[model samples]
Target: MFKNHPKGLAVLFFTEMWERFGFYTMIAIFVYYLQENFKWDQATVTNIYGIFMAGVYFTPILGGWIADNVLGYGKTIIFGAIVMGIGYAIMAIPTDNSYLVFAGLFVIAIGNGMFKANISVLVGNLYGHSEISLKDAGYNIFYMGINVGAFYAPFAAAGIKSFLMNNFGATLAQGYNAGFGIASIGMIFSLIIFTAFRKYYQQADYQSKKEVKVEKDVVLTKQQEKERIIALLTVFGIVIFFWMAFHQNGAALSLFARDYTHQFVGKFTYLLFDVVSLHAILFAIFGLAALLKKSNSSKIKSFGGIFTLAGLSLLIYKISSLPESGKISPEQFQAFNPMFIVLITPIIINYFSKLNKKGKEPSSPAKIGIGMLITAIAYVIMIIASLGLAPVYTLNGSTSAITVSPFYLIGTYFTLTIAELHLSPMGLSFVSKVAPPKMKGLLMGGWFGATATGNYLAGFVGRFYQEWELWQFFLILIVCAALASLMVVFTLKKLKSATS
Candidate 1:
């Protein structure tokens, strides 16, 4: 999978993996921390969670601008990582003060904004226009790095918190704080990896320290620019609903896990997962070495392949060994989507590759539309599973404490992960491929801005969870996702025409 791509992709991949580890780690515990530690009500927790995530997505506009016009992509990313690391460090302070928590989140959001869009632009810059077909595959690989971190973050948080409580005799709040501290450490690792390997990505942007000089040189006619903008905006608008449906994992879904799901995994399963972490690190190192290797030795190349297969086989063995009757936590269930991402990415890429060879690959916009429709189906599954479940919260926003089967969430996450595979990475690649060259950074930021809008809507929709039945809430998401999918379908031909 890493073959034929620029070596810099490996650097970006690992860097993003660690960065997402920090982000998802903090996010996995955030809502629970608010309720358990700060004693905030559901409304408050969901509200803050939505707003914080919105800010995180919203700031990329500024970050992208800075990278494009000021510091360039590399510097902006490094700077963003440092600032976010500081924010994570502050969040680790274990305070009851909501102000302090929000302050920390704000800083992290700002830093993420600066880093997110520019790094993607850098990846897109790595290949020539002729490699556009490969761009989607590249982004999918990059997207896998994100899921790899996401896949482990909840586990890490759960493990760390358990360790602190069992061994150190710390309170749950303190353990959560310690978990946040570890998240900070993850960001530090990301920064270190990027800074140490900065030289590898120099050619991605035509020089390590320089910005793209094509902003003014490669001018487009008015009609071409307008059509490009329209196509981007169309995708942006359609994807808003997709994100609104998708990001529920952090808010509404998190609540479902806390209140509805049966969470009681056995000790053996937990232990196996813990053991897998060591292998995760070892595999990452071996993979990195393989990607970075300049040698042509067949034996050396085979070593990386062997390590990859060994790691994956071990992972499958551990998962299959888990007792079916054993329950796990809601947060632990967060791992399922990313795990699916890691498992399914190669299949999706191969499917698309075959389609490309046959000249029958769906256009990026069509794939995104299909993704939205798939997301709607995911919610539909949840609605059906939630049929008999009662509301966990009263109309007046009080807890009722009724729970549902873990399979409800597990099945939902599995379905939605497939949707994410179709939409999220495709959206990134589409932006990289279709956005006007001179405005790539800004337009990429626009994609996130749409996500920001969707995140805000996600929070808005989350507010309904407190007042509505679980099925009703999910039904509403079905409507939203279906509507988005329809919108994309309506524009599919025009979007394809414009991009083609």
Candidate 2:
């Protein structure tokens, strides 16, 4: 898989893998930790989780700016990694002070803001060579690396938490703290690997010479700068709702899993493996296959078919299995999106590459518009799922906990994953492709900043899961995403012109 890609790819791939390991590991259990340890209500916990996630994404603006103007990308990534590692370690301390935990989370968030976009910029830099024209394919490969870490985090977290709680004489809270500690271990390992490979990534280090030239040669007119800021603000506004809907994995959807889903495999052979995170493993296999298939035409086509069929089957099965009782653990449901990414990314990439070959590939803006529409559809799916389930509010405005099958959430995830494939990677690719050569790291950070804006709002939206009925909460998301999608479609021609 690394044969045609840059040597830096391996270094960055593992670095990102370990980073995600820590990040996802913490995320997998964040809500559970809040509820179980702090004894907070679901609403309070979701609110806090949303805020933390939002902050985590929000700081990238500063991180990106710093990398662009002051610190080089390499230094920024290193600083971010160290800070995140410390943050993860701090979370392991089992402190009673929520303020301290918040402080730790802030550190992690800032670090993520710095590291996430810069590293992606570095990866895109690797493809500067003519031999690898497959930037999308390359990102699909990198994304698999991300999921490899994501795939392991839940099981590792669940195992550590379960062990501590069940055997080590720790309370659920302590077990959670221990799980956070294990996540820190993953971070430390990543830091070590990154540092060791530092020499190999010398090329990824940011350069100031080009930036100096760009600054000297071109001055932005008042109107141009104003327009740029306005454009960013507009994009940010749309993203807030997108993230609010997208980030349910860590909040509402996770709670749904714990409450509604039948996690146990009942007489089904796949259940045994899936319960232990085999589903994630399947995702990894597909991701790896997608990466390797870039050079092999026959293999790409065969794998593409298999991937599409598998995703379709999963979606069908989940929809078909919707039950009246909503009792699944939402965290388990969180696995579906990444799993879907694993399955669909390759097929999407391949399909697009084929289209590109025939001069029929859609522009990035068009793809993003399509993504938003699909995201809207996903929420609609959830809204439908909510309809069959018991409504939280009745005629008297009284709320009741209704039992809805886990399938509702699963169906949403399946649809959302398809939407994610359309948007997230393409978003990253867009930033890499359009960013000025000298401003690559900073511009990439800007892309993450857009996502961060969404992430922050996602936290606030998560509160809805606690305050409103399932349908009501999901309906808001459907409308928001639909509007965003429509906006994208309306401006598609203009965006294409700008990027072109």
Candidate 3:
């Protein structure tokens, strides 16, 4: 999977993996921390989530500009990581002051702004224009690195909380504090890795001023530049609704897990709830991948068999250790999307590769449009889950006794993960391929800017979780996603031409 890519790709991949570990750990607990410790209502908590997430994604504009004109990509990433560490440390301090926590989040966003866009731009810069055929695949691989960290994050956060509560008689608030501390450590690891391997990806750290000198042959006429920018903006505008629908995972979907979805289940039927159970499945998956690969040497297949045996043994041990039933955390449900992304990325990449080989691959813009359609389909599952449930406002903050099965959410997340693979990475690849070199950073920020708008809307819409029926809220998302998909159909030819 790593073959043919630059060595720097591996460096950036690990660095990003650790960075996402930190960010997602915070995400896993951010809402619960607010509601449990600060005693905030769901509306307020989700709104605040929107603000923090919006800022985190939106700041890339400044970060990208700084990288392009001043600090360059490498320096901005380093600076951002340090600032993020400080922010997490502040969040780790034990306190009743909500303002302080809010301040910490703001700081995290500032640092994230400087870090996020530049790193993505750096990844895009690794491939020259002649290698456009490989660019989408490259971004797909990078996206997997992000999900690998994300896949483990909720488990890490939950494990830390469970350990502290069991051993130290810690409060949930204390568990949250400790979890935030772990996030800081993750950031530190990211900073160290990036700094140590700085030279490998140094080639991607192009300053805007150097565009004329570095790649002078790929000149864009003023008219061509205008058309390309317009094409990108069109894509950005349509994708806003897709993100607005997708980011509901952190807010409305999370609430559904806690209040509306069944949390307790029969023995071994709840692997998503237990780390050991999850690990058994993870190990078995890797073992099978290695063993099933036709190209693997016999020696490698032997190791794969060993791993599979170990995983089976562990699974048996885990089942014996479990009681009849256990309650699951809402945060753990968030892991489903990322884990699915990690598991299925190789398949999606291979699928696209086959399509490309057959001369029938969808244009990047077309893939994004299909993603929007799939997002609508995902919400349809939610609409089904809501079919018999009472409205949340009527429940008065109590967990529903007639909760639907966890499969509803698991299915939704599985479908949404597929949508994410189709849209998010493709969008990044599209921007990198189309954006004029001089404006790469800024245009990349524009993509996140659209995401910022969508994230805020996710928060904004989350407030209506009570005001509207569950199906009503989901239907709204379906409408938005479908409309965006329709928009893409109308503009497909123009986008493909511009990107080409």
For lDDT, candidate 1 versus 3, the one ahead is 3
What local distance difference test score does each model get? 0.82, 0.70, 0.89
Candidate 3, clashing residue pairs? Answer: none
Question: By lDDT, is 2 or 3 better?
Answer: 3
Would you give me the overall lDDT of model 2? 0.70
Least accurate 10 contiguous residues by lDDT in model 1: 208-217
Two-way TM-score contest, 2 vs 3, winner: 3
Q: Judge candidate 3 at residue 485 and give its lDDT.
A: 96
**Model 2 stretches with alpha carbons more than 4 Å out:** 1-3, 129-133, 208-237, 263-265, 269-329, 391-402
Instruction: Kindly report the root-mean-square deviation of model 3 from the true structure over all alpha carbons.
Output: 1.5
lDDT (C-alpha) at residue 443 in model 3? 87
TM-score of each: 0.89, 0.83, 0.97
Kindly list the per-residue Cα lDDT of model 3 for residues 134-230, writing each as its tens digit.
8898899999999989888898888899899999999999899888999999999999999999889887876865654344225788988999999
Q: Look at candidate 1 and tell me the lDDT of residue 480.
A: 89
How do all the candidates rank in terms of lDDT, highest first? 3, 1, 2
Model 3, stretches more than 4 Å misplaced?
212-217
lDDT by residue for model 2 (1-500), tens: 56666687889889998999889989988888877777787667777886787677767767777787888788888899988988988899887799888888888888888888888877776565332237666776788678778867777777787787788788888887887898888888888888898877776566533443332123445654444444434454555566778887777667656554445433232332244334434644564466455566776757756765565466446445644333223455555666666666767776887998998888766777787888888877677666755533231322335555556676788788787777776766666655556566666666766776677677777776656887888888888889998888776665654443
The sequence of per-residue lDDT tens digits that candidate 1 reaches over residues 1-500 is 78988889999999999999999999889888888897878888888888988899989988887777677788889999999999999999978887998889999999999889988988888877667678889999999999899888998898899999999899999989988998999999999999999888877653222434453123457898798899899899899998898999999988777666655655444532353744554575565467457764777777777777777677667667666545456678778787778877987998999999999999888899999989999988788767777775652443335556666777888889889988999899888877776677778899999999899889889999878887889999999899888898778898887656
